[model samples]
Target: MDYQPDGQTPYQNTHSQNMALASLILGTLALLTCGCIYFAVVCASLGIIFALLSKGGSLTMNTSGKIGLVLSSLGLAFTLLLYIGLFLYVLKTYGGFDGFMQESLNFYGVDSIEELYQMMGVPY
Candidate 1:
């Protein structure tokens, strides 16, 4: 039984594939820039968005999109965990956030907050 349909064919566009490709690229970038909190977060967020969009229409997603989602999630998780650990360590070691900041400035050889401000050429 051969059932041939009518003559109207749907428009074939590569937009979904492009989204998958973009997701992959952003996910890769998120991993690459893991040391930078801002870049890592931004790239991972964008990658996840693109991946979801690529997976929006159907039950299955392209391999690249799946990989992108995984990598992006891993990057975001690693970055968040790292920062949280560092924050907790700093909080434990120092009396408070302000103390930690002051200690950091002192470690950098700035005698006081005013000196740091002066070094940065901020009129205070």
Candidate 2:
């Protein structure tokens, strides 16, 4: 039976706000799980979005949501970059780059990278 002078009722209740905060907490926990980088990233992104939206919608923004957003985003970015770097390292270690360079050189009738190195006058 809460009333406002403007005859408008608040759209959110304490329970709903608490639930939202809990959701944010749970999402954050899920993000921290091992091998769940993608999931964590997604959860964090959603949490941030939800938190911002809740703030705009006149819902209280909890501290947990803020922390979760920051942690999750960082975790996601770090994990994503790490995964990309790992894949790149694997590709490079497996001779992917060297093979491609060798094929290109063969097309140009070069016997070795050393020949190109010599032509470029670059020391080994």
Candidate 3:
């Protein structure tokens, strides 16, 4: 029952607007959690999906949707780069995945993977 100043019914695009808002929120979360690579990836992916969905049948997206898409994309890229860099660093410093595992187990005073799991209270 909303009307414009000219006494005409206001055009309502509620669904699209809601989708755009969700995209924005998720995009922000993705950016904030970029350091947590896995979480950032999940949030960024969902944000991108919502941003695209907000476009509906239109060829163009609203401002919020566009911003969300950009933010989410950047977040995802940053997360990937961060993880890749960490992996390379670990490989160089530890000699390999096995060396890294050995170091971790030694640091935790665990003789084997099963012992580590038991120490962490995880059922082996």
| Candidate with best lDDT | 3
What residue runs in model 1 are displaced by over 4 Å at the alpha carbon?
1-15, 108-111, 119-122
The clash numbers for all candidates, in the given order, read 0, 0, 0
Q: What is the lDDT of residue 43 in candidate 3?
A: 92
* Candidate 1 local lDDT, 1-124, one digit each (tens): 2223654555433338888989999999988888899999999999999998997656788898999999898888888988998899988999779989888898879988899889989999
Of 1 and 2, the candidate ahead on lDDT is: 1
Q: Which number leads on TM-score?
A: 1
Q: Write the per-residue lDDT of candidate 2 for residues 14-113, one digit (tens) a residue.
A: 3335545754774565456525666666666666665565454444556665665565566566667767787688677656777667777887677988
User: RMSD (Cα, Å) of candidate 3?
Assistant: 4.0
* Candidate 1 TM-score, C-alpha based: 0.79
Candidate 2 has a TM-score of: 0.48
lDDT measured at residue 65 in model 3 versus the true structure, 0 to 100: 94
